[model samples]
Target: MTQVEARDSRGTEGSPDPESGTRRARVRRAVGALSRPGPWKRGRLLATPAALLGLLMLLHAHITDRGGLGSLVESMLPWFGVFVPVLLAGALWRRSASAVVALLLPVVVWLSLFGGLLVDKSHAGGDLTLVSHNVGAGNTDPAATARDLTASGADLLALEEITSQARGVYEQELAKTFPHHTVLGTVGLWSKLPLSDTRAVDIQQDVGPLGDAKSDDQKLPYNRALRTTVATDEGPLAVYVAHLGSVRVMPRNGFWTDSRDRNATALAKALATERNERVVLLGDLNGTMDDRAFAGITAQLHSVQDEAGNGFGFSWPAKFPVARIDQILVRGVEPESSWVLPATGSDHLPVAAGISW
Candidate 1:
């Protein structure tokens, strides 16, 4: 029990605990990390993906004519772009000054693409004014739709989904405004001026089971498109009124746009080969101009509403329009004014466009 033996025994019993020291060091390190800024790191992680998606959308619009997938992407991309700026702002909310600047990528993209669309209308000149409407297959009141269309005072009108049952009502109503008109299959046209050389443009191919139903009384739906020349104030303008293919959304099926895509291809091919330089295509199209299914039509003709309409201009359901399924498209004609008219007891609101050649 001497002093040296006592010290040695105490040292062995309570040597500086290596485990406790390591634990204390870890705690200090964690506290230091907590004191440091972290929001910026988190913000960068979120902002990068959003900024990239925004850029990809713009690039898609340029490199390829939007197909079905691209159109779906386009319609949704604007809302997505909105988040890019907001997320960037959030990244800066609790972080360093440099975080605010990170939003420039999305800011530039949004401004370059959508800013022009927001600007005040500048007059684009065209020679003739045209109107296009689907007129709705289940439209209960054809006369009302026709009268409303006549009131619009369009030089040329294209109608689609003109049911045989309602055809007479449309003709009777439209005859007062347009003396010259033509009806082929389920579509028809009325012109305040004159129309000529009417022909069915054969909008269908041997693709669907419905296509093979040749029986005169077969209760199957057949695909068809029509074309005619309207003698406008400008000149003879080739007017095509087409109901390409309807798209449906089902709970089980994602999106049914295949028929539409094929029909769009056919319509696009026909339009590309048209002899007339000044062409106008008007119809239901079963899709928005923003939709890729209408790329063939959009590529050939410019939407009057997208060019000149004031707002979202939704035209479906007549009562409330969520998406603009009805459209007025023109090639070689400048859209002067565009608007969706009031509903006329139909599922779709009548869309009108004033154009000059």
Candidate 2:
């Protein structure tokens, strides 16, 4: 019945439980705070769109062509893989689980498609060496470009877009290093070894009544393809030098590469019917190997750069190469190494590959 007893009756008992109750309250508050959403939620939500787009791009091949534009994008489809790294950086910065998971989709798809090309399969030595370049129709310094390519220590050189004006400069400059050279129309082949059985390759886009055809009565020879046999230590190697017609993605025209595509088809057929088993195609194809338009050529030959180069080895737009319009495809020969040479005055950087029998 004293003060202690009165306090106990009022539920404010003189006990050691107040501190424990306060501790339990603080623990509950900490648990509640820990259960709240984190920064990763924002990243996860933001990554949904990109993940969906990645899924869509995975089926780029299935996308129907819209007047030849689809093939252009499909040809560079593997380039989209570059975005995955940027996405990964964002995911890491935001501590995102969903973003990271989404990134895996593009990574897998890209690797499955082009991982082999990223590998370094080049050998130590090669028997034959070659270089290919589009020496632009408007190149300002043909002599400089010729010197640059000649310095590459290649056994053979194939040039595209050799204008009548600049062809002389190249011919004069290259004559010292490449003793054996031939120019057929705008395309030309210069080799250190002896060349024989050289001829102009037809590149007319005659579609009969369906498409327009122009007569070459003047024999001005706008032919953009050539073939020659180069006698080397490894025997005769049949080489085709070509410059496919340029393509323009005009607003009205929409992937206007009709002449280029037609020329590609003709070139493919010519390559298919080649009598020589050892063949090398070097030129500015104006389309990538991934393009179905080049199926005929690709079916018979393999890209040396894709097989033996260190990286993507892009060679167009010498200032900032984005794609490898120039190429070196080979058959019945082993590619030892492939690489992109430094830029010259020309619009395109030269591409080179080494091979052996």
Candidate 3:
């Protein structure tokens, strides 16, 4: 063979193939680009904020509620995810590898906290179907709201914010479908099964200074919660219907929740003493399950929506719901399905859940 042919057959001793050399150069360029100061440092502003967002979510429960700020944040915690995309866009625009990588922290934390809620976990059958609604006192058409509720085919219905004037309207409208019913002040429960041992639950009775100042006569008008026993085939089921006091944000008082928080505490005490093995609490609690104020209540009962619902099941401000303040919580039963009902005449939409004994 010729010298060139012989050399070619033997291959080059020290020289790499052109393709392999090109690959090595490309890899080195990539490594150098990533290792450079600019790529790592360009979006420090964005990266820091992204990391803080993740930390905020990771430690939201530890946040202080001295001025109700913690509850406010926890109430809207899920919405914080909206920032992820915004930060991601900024990272891409800045070509920031660090910023992009930082985003993974929040994304993972958010998914860890609320990812299961996004999936459809509802099942088909249940022993009971119950619905709860805060039929607004300002609702002009209680009759129409009653009609809409009856169409739900629920076995039990709990109504909150029932006005003195509309009590007769609801009682009359719902009597045919739900034969057994009780209305104690502003909250009421109507059931297809037998109801007994019904009593008004004074959620504001022990609300410290504010409660002490009010006389029994004065407090009667503000009674907005109740407890009752519904006789189901499975046995006596204890039911609590409540409309906790409203929260307000005033200029002087940061997120004012004194009334609601007190009411929640009183209601929790009532729940702790309950002797019934199976219990269901339905109402417009005026706060989400995540809020620390409901820690007492949430500790004993589990949210049906969280257990067996599709998505977040937001039910307030009927126009555009962003939170699941209207809740159906149960103890000693399995949640088969949970959902948000369509808007009625009230500002708040209804929420429903089906449970099996």
Candidate 4:
């Protein structure tokens, strides 16, 4: 036989091809390594952290609030996702099957908690458009803030942190858009519809240990919540406007939310006893709805943002908002759409929601 014939015969007889042999060997090695028990035993360090993160998200409510750590974590619970990618990178670098499997827990838990918020659930049109803003007490240009609010075309407006000095500016600037209005201490309600049964809600700001020491005059400034009735064509809609106490993070005390928690409890109680069938709460709650401290309030009213907003709708620290502390929650009404307004002259961006009867 000729040389070419001999080469064909050798190929047909399965002569060992170095490249093909190398490829088969590599495949076998990869399969063997994956099937081996050694990979499951590797990356214990990565596995431990991944397991802890999953448990933290799963049992965040069970975590103790001894140093207000529970509240702090819950407030930023959604952000816990930042660790998942880091853990995944480590798992990939280590090529540990166990670490990759462990990561499934946190991924599932986080998605279960906040995945819905990532979707857009809003629809067009509603009976009333309500806007709530903190309006910052230190706002230098109250007139401009009021104008921005008026431009929102809201049927009802709730303003919190309205200082006595700038109150008149807001009143003057917003009067044309919102004809019927009431200012109770620092909290106020402005509406195109007639308002009645307007009164200050004692959110127990002056009933606490330190608050008890203050006189009536001193307690006047702490009046940061109100209740009012807006006579809509549908019916008399009970409205609540509130600015819960500020939260602080101190080196010694950790997450200091005593004041805000007290206010939330008091507000929840008030909501529990509300006679009105249709209720709407608009405010700067000073805490996210996910925090356990608002369990009482959250149990009664569902957030419009959660129901109808496009995203998380975080409304605090307008320059770089990281949380949705400003809220419009409702009971006995349908939320049509929810959105965050443009930044005003305050620290908070206004939140608005349209509700139907």
Residue 22 shift from truth in candidate 3, angstroms: 20
Model 3: runs farther than 4 Å from truth? 1-37, 205-220
Q: lDDT per residue, candidate 4, 59-100, as tens digits?
A: 999999977899999999999988999999998888888999
In candidate 4, stretches whose alpha carbon ends up further than 4 angstroms from where it belongs are 1-37, 206-220
The residue pairs found clashing in candidate 3 are: none
With candidate 2 superimposed using the best TM-score fit, by how many Å does residue 321's alpha carbon deviate from the native?
Answer: 0.8
Off by over 4 Å in 2: 1-44, 205-221
TM-scores, in order shown? 0.75, 0.84, 0.86, 0.87
lDDT of 3 by residue, 47-109 (tens): 999999999999999999877899899999999999999999999999999999999999999
RMSD of each: 7.5, 4.9, 7.9, 6.4
Model 3 compared with the native: what TM-score? 0.86
TM-score of 4: 0.87
Among the numbered candidates, top lDDT falls to: 3
Error at 187, model 4, angstroms: 0.6
Q: On residues 194-217, what C-alpha lDDT tens digit does candidate 1 reach at each position?
A: 788888776663332333344223
TM-score of 2: 0.84
Per-model C-alpha lDDT, please?
Answer: 0.71, 0.82, 0.91, 0.90
**Alpha carbon lDDT at 159, candidate 1:** 83
